[model samples]
Target: MTVKMIAVDMDGTFLNSQQDYDREKFSQLYQVMKQQGVRFVIASGNQYYQLKSFFPEIEGELSFVAENGAYVVSEGEEIFTGEIDPEIIQEVLTILAKFKQGHTILCGKNSAYVNEDEPDSFIEHGQKYYHRLKKVPNLFDVKDDTLFKFALSFPVEQVPEVLVQLHEALGDKVIPVSSGHGDIDLIIPGIHKAHGLMKLQELWGIKNHEVAAFGDSGNDLEMLKHAGYSYVMSNGQPRVKVAAKEIILSNDENGVLLKIEELLGN
Candidate 1:
């Protein structure tokens, strides 16, 4: 099938175990795709700054669907943004306060805010994902920023329980999805990677059938389903493998690039 755009999830689907890739090969592949008018979109549950850091050479050339689709950036500008209502944010935080088992990060357009009460280890771990992180006295007290989502980290075993409680407490007003690595993201209802991708498709006049997507986790589910050519990495979660149209090699083997190369007839 003819592909006009490609969206890839970062952690397990694109980046290898070391969180790096073949720079030279990717650069060459990007150049060819650009010349062929194929858009490359980095669709991740990561922050925009974190995602941008990976593609310095092509910073303004690609699109970013960050925060599990709460924010969308293109050409160095925010084209679309989905934020949780303040009331809902407060309610969610209240529910989280009861559990007291995870570290909570208030994701905003400007920065990610962590409560001062969190352990030092949690802050350090959060810094690995959130580039512009701020330690605040209280998350709910932080204002004047467009809050997109709540990123929470808990014990891997507790993820299932957390998701269930979140859904029960928040009802259909919020969306809770696991992003792997013992993390769960709470976004506004109906907002996700696929929603963010649809915005880009509308902006570019592209269609689902003209797009190719790769992903490896729960957060990448909607995105995979939105594309006609969906690829689940060999190392992806079992659910993702079942949802995808095809399965490719693991990220450690540079499977994403290999598939793209084959698509380009390299």
Candidate 2:
């Protein structure tokens, strides 16, 4: 019951289905943790901009593990970062461009680019998930300096096939994992949500057991398993539920905040 740091996931773990950030209870719990000197780290598979959507008011206080733990930003500073080899990212993009004609989302630092082959909802969802992003006519033609990750959206049943094809094509050089239903994220190997949380743990001088983590998707598996105290959403994948130390309420029930109060006894 004496946790020194709380590392939370973003999408399904913290936010509700409507994608609105619930502030009242969460803000109060955050104040309690602050008074106890326990740090809060937002460890997620999202980019920095996407993660920023959750804590717009207290931007400076939140630390983030972005792009599936390949990057970390603390107190508005870059504490840890690992980039996918530019050549590998470009190669994957080219191959996917040829093989799959579906929408391709190019994830970078602050913005993500998507080809014109997406539905209007895709853009709107991206806008909702990320604080800022751009949908362009052609993503491949854009000359960006670096890319953190790339993703493709297809039917849930087809995701495994797509991921297998991508993994076979790219091999071990790039890390390919799922974001949630119908989406797969290709990031650099060794960079995951758990890795990012460990970085924050080091920064805050806390041990793994002193932290409690929550998540609800495939990308969250590694992170959830690594936490001293871990939870999976009631609506989470079967595999994830099995791996977690405990199962909590669904996101709609404000499960993350409920667990926070339970663990810290606030």
Candidate 3:
């Protein structure tokens, strides 16, 4: 099958368990894909700044479906954005307050806001995914910023129940999706990785059938289905595997790069 654009998730689908990839091989592969007019898109739940750091060599050339599709950046420009209403953000924060546990981050276009009272370890962990993090006295007082999503981290065992409660409380106002490791992101309704991909398709005039997507978690379900060629990493969640059209090796094995090589007959 012919592929024009490729969208990949970061954590488990592209990066290995160590959160790193085969840079040498990927750098080479990127050059080849560029020459062939193939677009490489990083679709992740991470912030745009964090995603951009991974592709310094291909910065402007790469596309980003960041914040789980709440934001899209192409050619170094923000082409589309889906921000949550201020009132809705307040409601979500209120529900989170009831839990009184887990780390909460308010995702914004400029920076991510976190509670100043969080433990240093938790703040450091948040830094890993959110590059532009700011400690705030109160999340409710965060103003004059374009809020994208709310990301929370709870104990792994508490994830299921927390997700259910948030869904029931928030209803149609937000889309709560897990990005594995007990992390949940509250996205704007009707906006997700798939929606971001569709926006890119329109701008590039590329058809869905010409897209190849790789992902490994619940948040990636819609994206995998949207592509003509969908691959679930061997290490991906069980439900993600069921939704994908095919399966490939784990991230550490360079599954995504290998598949692309095979497709390009390299």
What ranges in model 2 sit over 4 Å off? Answer: 117-119
Worst 10 residues of 2 by lDDT: 124-133
Rank candidates, TM-score, best first.
3, 1, 2
Clashing pairs in 2: none
* Tens-place lDDT digits, model 2, residues 102-123: 4567877757777666788877
Clashes of each: 0, 0, 0
In order, the Cα lDDT scores of the candidates are 0.91, 0.79, 0.92
Residue lDDT tens for model 3, 1-266: 78999999999999998899999989888888989999999999999999999988778888999999988999899989887889988988887788876789999999999999999988999999999999999999999899989999999999889889888888888888999999999888779999999999999999999999999998999999999999999999998999999999999899999998887769
* Candidate 3 wrongly placed segments (more than 4 Å): none
Tell me how far the alpha carbon of residue 100 in candidate 1 is from the true structure, in angstroms, after superposition.
Answer: 2.2
The TM-score obtained by model 1 is 0.98
Ranked by lDDT from best down, the candidates are 3, 1, 2
lDDT of 1 by residue, 83-190 (tens): 788988888888888877887999999999998888999999888889999998888898889998899999999998888988888787778899988999888778
Which pairs, if any, clash in model 3? none
TM-score (all chains, Cα) for each model: 0.98, 0.92, 0.98
* Deviation from native of the Cα of residue 204 in model 3, angstroms: 0.6
The candidate maximizing lDDT is: 3
